[model samples]
Target: MTNKTFCVVCKRDDASVIDMQPHLVRCLQCGAYEIMAIEYLQMTNQEQDPLLSAWIRNRTEEQASPPLLTSSTWISLRASLRIPNLREKQAALMKAFARRSMFPGTVGRYNPVADFPLAWAANEGELRFLKQDLIARQLLDNEYTMGGSFLITAKGWDYLDSIPAGGVFSDQVFVAMSFSDTMRTAWTSAIIPAVRQAGYTPYRVDAAPHIDRIDHKIMVEIKASRFLIADVTEQRAGVYFEAGYALGQELPVIWAVREDDLKNVHFDTRQYAHIVWKNERELEKGIYETIVAVIGRGKSH
Candidate 1:
């Protein structure tokens, strides 16, 4: 059974709380997420509500359930969650249609008010801008109206087709991690296998074949790959740099750190969630779960 109540995350009244161990909430605005009673009581993320709300909204992927947020995940996600840029949001909206449409030219009408979060917009007006831009770019129908059917154009189909298929070209994932002698076992046993298990090829720049200037090559590899995993165990400046570059490219980043070393993570980035692990086994589980949650299972999964 589900009980109606205001959402703890978004404070929206249309939320239904499932009667269970860890409270499971389904909110019209924030989608569905599971939170522990203890974690809820200890929550300190009130200061960053907007970002958290938007993050929850975006997690309502095609059919995936919302991720479980313990004390650990909430902090990492809160620290790293950012409002996507306009172009990124536009792409997301189109990709959504591409994935959800049954066939080409399938007519769809999404509510600008109720579905604004689908495009990561703050309000209906921002979502209107997205539809307007798509209409102008010939990605959507040319009609101008407030509430009506929205259709993806033939050009939109062609555009989505031009994107990489079969996850063929972008299956590689760049790993930004320390090469510390202490981390070798974790690298080989934990991170690499976890990525491969998730169906992505992991490429650590250090292990890749490269002839260009090291710095330039790192950036090139990052740009050509899918997402990146950043482990800041040793506080390496290079790891931070690569992670920042990937963020600039608007790629998903799964952050991880050794539990013992987590306290040393930079103050600016400590807010973002990092899979803090005391052992390689914990690290592997956290990394795999996070990859599935943030970017969905890769081609291999």
Candidate 2:
């Protein structure tokens, strides 16, 4: 075996450096402070890496079974990983593992942009930071060599399990619609009331005072909402972008379009089931049913 220092968390050897005289090293990639082999061995005969050993023991108990891909627990776990910080990238990496492990015959490497579009790094430095944060948190296993993939540990799964699926903003529903007078009126008179009946608070951008950074406000709302309702009646580019962003975050999105404008819905989004309505009443009814089905009954107020 090659003698090298690696993060006890994200086993990558590249970013770790000797921190003390003996048996102590810190991984800059994932921010893991670990005891070296000699000290680790002296402390416990169970294994050189206690964290890895526990994970192995757990896996062996279950016959090395793969993660449950279809369980709600798994869905929530994956969705919760999309944090706003470097943890988002780390979660995406773990999600990639869960996804790959689900399909037996599938073979390919993880592509940050393709698999983790929401948390894709802008540059190598950002990617490095993300990996480092994951390692430091002990959520990811370290790689022993360059270009090696890291694995999620038992602690990682435990951490994910502790995160609530819907979180605090689970009852907030964001509306992405045209900013026309007719649309605004429909939202206030019809959509808002229907959303209220369905137990979710409907939020529209226009409700806020206009600011120079409107897009930033929209993004913040999108992140804060449990789901999004995108009205593509006018084929607004912004609505499409908002919906795409929600999808990237693994948030549920309800697509809506006027019956007359249905033909103009973007081809890329046309495949998804959309609520086609002729009037405000029809839109309200359709949206209400969709919301209940997607998110279940909202918290009783």
Candidate 3:
């Protein structure tokens, strides 16, 4: 009889007498999608090598389910913020949050940045918890302190900059969204027609071309275009990279994602204003709305 072991996710080690093959486990504790024997060995031996230890830690954290903010902790922080001195301390902590270096023995007090530890220690655990939360949210740097004031990290600042005024988007719009293979084909076919109908020349950049010599031409064409229409399905890395390039150039770019894949999008991309659709009707409606909201305001691409 073949030896059998339980899967980490299922936690069932018993091998059926009829079928004794080893099975992978899925660990609910960590929300790991699949836990193979090889992965288990890697995890167990991560500490043997310093490089592997760091790599494993990063991978594990990345794959682990997101942590939820504790209600009690949130309430405590909110109440503490109401205190006059604590309010100032919280402000100081926020200002210092993004700095990469810290002075020991300082935090909320004036000139506290001179002694980082003092400021951190003075806040007790509440400030520490709040700081950690900010780091997790990408609102602050994990290891940063400046002369007792907290600063937003570059990433945090970029995120803040991405938000349009009054939450009313004006630079980007969704011109198309499709999910099924049929829908995708139809949307692709309609793109040129739709843009033309909108009184704009239909300049296109085929984002999903096979790796070939034509890739250069595609890029050149995109660069020459006055506006961008990005299709973000299957999470194509190239599509996302190109979309970002257009955005950086201050071009008006429309973001369209498949409705079924909305939950699978990365946090950075999902946070941005976007349109999602699953069918042709939804796509048309979404595009019209985006046109009226972002393109109609005389915002130049």
Candidate 4:
């Protein structure tokens, strides 16, 4: 008789077979494997087996939690997850921490155990798995403790640099404006067209098909955009926040306001040059010219 085998899914030898069946095994690691003889053969020949190929693809996808969509900040750091792999995700997370640690006025080293960005993880368990994986691979320095600090190893930096560009931040322009009927007309009739003429895609948060946390989505769009066009015609607080955030990221902000409403613009922002347009034609013409002058054709930064 042959020796009892391990779970085929996770390769754990400790898993027990169902009802003493040698062909069917349960996985202890993921608690998800219930392998039949045919399924086992299919899994082994996944490339040649269509059913097993689809199952494996689906299972691999299900491993990623729903709420943990990759963010544009990861793109800006040149660490976006282009391929679905543990090492890539770990590298992106580590690079995010490294960026925060280098931020102006940052006093201490990043403590990933305590300071892992929650926005990047779906839950505490997912975060823990990432940390443990990195530690196991010797890419991060620290024990699994509350006060433990995370310092990337030299190998970790090499891994980060090895990641290919994900191109999440393409030639895109984020448009910030009021959602009123007039502003909507302005955007659809003038702003968006001008952006396209300037050779960049324009995106507005309200136009997105999927409903998500509004602020979170907006921030993601801002980070992904090559530049920002802020129309403070109504002086909406959200518009101001978006513009200010873009400026803080050192992204170029193209300020605009209605000719009549220019007086309502904040005192501080008024210091910068702005496009004061009286009508849609003026808005379109001014924005197109400004984009051509400020961001030149074919340039993404």
Per-residue CA lDDT of model 2 for 1-301, tens digit only, reads 2245644333445534444434334333322233544554333322123223222222222222222222233235344432244554455444445444434322324443222222234334555567667767776655521143445656766765554332232467889999887687668777898898998778888776544277766776676677889989888899999999989867788988999999999999999999999888998999989888877766534
- Where is model 1 more than 4 Å wrong at Cα? 41-50, 70-72, 144-148, 164-301
Ranking by TM-score: 1, 4, 2, 3
Per-residue lDDT of model 1, residues 18-37, tens digit only: 87877887877667788876
For model 4 the TM-score comes to 0.49
Cα lDDT over the full model 4: 0.61
Worst lDDT 10-window in candidate 4:
65-74
> Residue pairs in steric clash, candidate 4?
none
Lowest summed lDDT across 10 adjacent residues in model 2 is found at 61-70
Error of 1 at 298 (Å): 17
In the range 95-115, model 4's lDDT, one tens digit per residue, is 555554553223324433323
TM-score of each: 0.54, 0.48, 0.35, 0.49
TM-score of candidate 1 to 2 decimals: 0.54
lDDT of each: 0.75, 0.59, 0.44, 0.61
